[model samples]
Target: MSGDAPISTPWRPSKKDARYTGPRACVKCHAEESATQHLTAMGRALEPVATSEILRAHPRLTFRSGPYAHEIVRRGDQSLYTVTDGVNTISEPILYTFGQGKAGQTYIFRHDGSFYESRLSFYKDIQGLDVTIGYPREIPPSLEVAAGRRISMDEARNCFSCHGTGAAYGNQLQLDRLVPGVTCEACHGPGAEHVAAMEAKQFKDKRIFNPGKMSADDLSQEFCGSCHRSAEQVISNKLLRGLITVRFQPYRMFTSRAHDPADMRLTCTACHNPHENPSADEAFYDPKCFACHRSFASLKSPAVAKTEEKEGRTDKACPVAQSLCVSCHMPKVEFPGSHFKFTDHRIRIAKAGEQFPN
Candidate 1:
């Protein structure tokens, strides 16, 4: 990691006493970015349960696993999560919804002053409820356990830190002051000082962290990876094995042969624009792939090859098709029980009926 790289720990206080000014303050100069970013998945990562569009739209969702029946229903402005096993029943008002529902949305509710992650989540692929990822498959021993899993204070802090901004301070979570979803300050550091400096027409000492200043490796491994799950984090957590690792893009990407620490072309921003929603159009990524993998016809030209070699762009041409490279190379693998297929970021020539690579 670069010494200049901003600390990877989310919600950690800035070196100075700069406070969070919220995303509205960022709209003054970055109107377009702020507007578009709010529409992205990262922008709506965490939402208050009462105002969740997915829950409001569905109204009611139910799932059956073993002897327990889980259900979530919208009541007036609030949503209620209930679990029952014939006789015993547990119900609570959902406090938070922890996803944008592109694939799924999990509910988090407070039970007896403690936070609990609902056992079942709404999966878009199934258009209904199912067990949340990583939850046990076996039947629960009691109604309380069937209702949801209790989470540690540190885990709750980390969850809110990533899903929302301005939620954690020091060792505590200030839920009352939490900002739902990732805003500009979440990645760029708190904007209060920057906003003040800009309003005062002082360009010098605009106190804010710019992730763009970090090197390619630092940006990939530490900056974006901090939330996306870096290779080091996955390995350290013993999550390097199985198809579940596919959801961790940075870790899978780091394992790819195309992952060159020195090459900016292989970095996350090379293909994705964080301010915008990710597009599924394969054509959109062909240019990024071609930046390194030249066309076979282009490689045959001696002059072009010589210039490329001189410019330190000597990556070999692809023997296969040119466009839609990601369709074949980065195949989507469906994780068991999640009901969603994640695009494996480990770019490679995928073979039919082959086992998933670690």
Candidate 2:
């Protein structure tokens, strides 16, 4: 999403033979989400760095000017630009926050030792020009110059089989890390088929499964709409790259009517604690209305049992107490790389003209 590939096969990672098999080596029963949620970006994007953490502070910096092998991607303080040099090279398109242009994003080059697919800068500035934000299917300005056609690990196993983590798709493919952008076996399953069904204790999944054992209210909201709901496009017309990965179902709260809760055991990790930080900590907000609405005389709705008996508070509330219960139902929403405080998991009602939904 940064480099400009159109010079004839400079981007790489195809013809399979890939491999990343690192981190959990078959997850080992999620082992506390492989260190607080598959190691971090809240779930997956590019972790394998650390040559002394990229030589600390560019310690003498120089992957030989540039062509590839000198890294650095960080967003909110400006850092883009990586390289392993051609057959897939990245670096450029910096703007962690400046009107959030650069249509979502797409930077993952690295090639042979693993990383694939790059180039997706579909443009965005709208009222200021350079439009074309990948509508129905515009990309054909000749595949928008990604080192002239090089994104192919089948265009990156459809966005790395769910933002990658311990993926091993054969004929040569191996990943164990990609940065923390998605994890817990990416929607839970491939820890080498549940670590060989838990060491023959004849394992019935020692943990993390059972969407109430899927009793079907449309298979528990399609097990979180397979990634928060935005399907159909099947192939072509670009658009797709691990949007906060799993349980974002239908993607980014897919028209979230508070994520369709009539309480079919309402899930999305139920008020989301997907390993942490969607502003959690109401002892993990409303476990299905605090397990049947936490006995404010069993709340059959006397105005939500008098607002939980006038916020008497639970387990001792105070999560920045707006009478806790998740500070008046999922609040905050500062946006723009978050240093300004970001919130908004869609659990709504802080309205004012479609106000702050970014």
Candidate 3:
């Protein structure tokens, strides 16, 4: 038998009252929010390999990336992933499925009690397995443990902690105990005390951490930036430029002129609802921007519209395109290898045929 490994610091707060009660507890009171959140990408961020329909959708999933060949074989009740480096082969049962299969779905497999990410991912837009985002295309011949990135135990824990809820319990990475995706406790902290208070009809402070109540700087840096990389994190990691870095919305938004230090509503939650699935409609965000840029008083005026072609009625908004403000300011720029189009969060007036902003 093997000895126990050393325990690291706990991921969540050490407060005695902060215990997770799962998402079901929140459904009783916040039914609408909970129901809608369950449909979001964050809600289905992670799941067990067995629960993933993507794997079963394609019986024999295979892809070749550079010098390695990867395949996921379904064997009755189990799914086995095999990775080969031409001469060497390593096969393991797929343990977990990362992502919601919206952008992509990455697999995780265990070997020698350590977890490693599969090189190939099923991109929804592309509808095929390809090299995982930010991973090298060609793995070296010397590395034969897996046909993918061999992440450390700490890395594995961190990845799960972000993808799912209750991943870390008292300095231990308990994947089995994980709730499998971002649940109620992920953003609002643990809900055990809150549930108890609700049950007791106390109507007092439930000891739940609400990001909306935090200060502007704290809300942006510690709250939203907890998952979305903070300004400091992006700069520290040296991910300043390139299309790959566009995914770091907080860092980009922090650098934008729209982010006012004096205002609390200028944060990410201003445009995005934490409980709802993010919509792709560019016009949906125009009202959020117009709240700060243009006056609501203009919208109330029952004046002659442009569609009616009324003479002497000039619109104060953008002369060219008015409604879809995001399509012009926050243009969707395609990354080199990704099929998904990432809207630049650095809110700026983009010139036509201009290079991507640095």
lDDT of each: 0.81, 0.38, 0.71
The whole-model C-alpha lDDT of candidate 2 against the native structure comes to 0.38
Give all TM-scores, in the order shown. Answer: 0.93, 0.27, 0.86
Give the alpha carbon lDDT tens digit for every residue of 34-124 in model 1: 7799878899999997778899999988888788888888899999998888887888999999986555788899998899988788887
Clashing pairs for predicted structure model 3, backbone only: none
In the range 1-358, model 2's lDDT, one tens digit per residue, is 2211111110112324423334457456456656566434435443332321222333222223223344344544344544444465445432111112223233344534444433332112221112112222223332224222344554454444444443434423344433234555454433444455466676655643434455333333454443333322211124343321222233434444544434443455555556654544655555454543344342345665556656542322222333245455555543332122334444545555454443
Best by lDDT: 1
* Candidate 3 error regions (>4 Å): 1-11, 14-18, 85-87, 142-146, 295-319
Candidate 2 ranges with C-alpha deviation above 4 Å: 1-103, 111-120, 123-162, 167-184, 187-190, 193-268, 272-358
lDDT string for model 3 (1-358, tens) is 0011213212255343347888998998988888788768888888776767777777788887566677888887678988777787888998888886555688888876677887678888867788776665555544453366677767777787778887776556777668888877877767788788878988877667677777776777666777777777777765456666688788888888767665665677777888887778877887776555533344555543432224322325454565878878888888765667877889888899987766
Minimum summed lDDT over a 10-residue window in model 1 is located at 1-10
Separately for all candidates shown, the number of backbone clashes (residues 3 or more apart, or on different chains) is: 0, 48, 0
Ten-residue region with minimum lDDT total, candidate 3: 1-10
- Top model number, TM-score: 1
Q: State candidate 2's TM-score.
A: 0.27
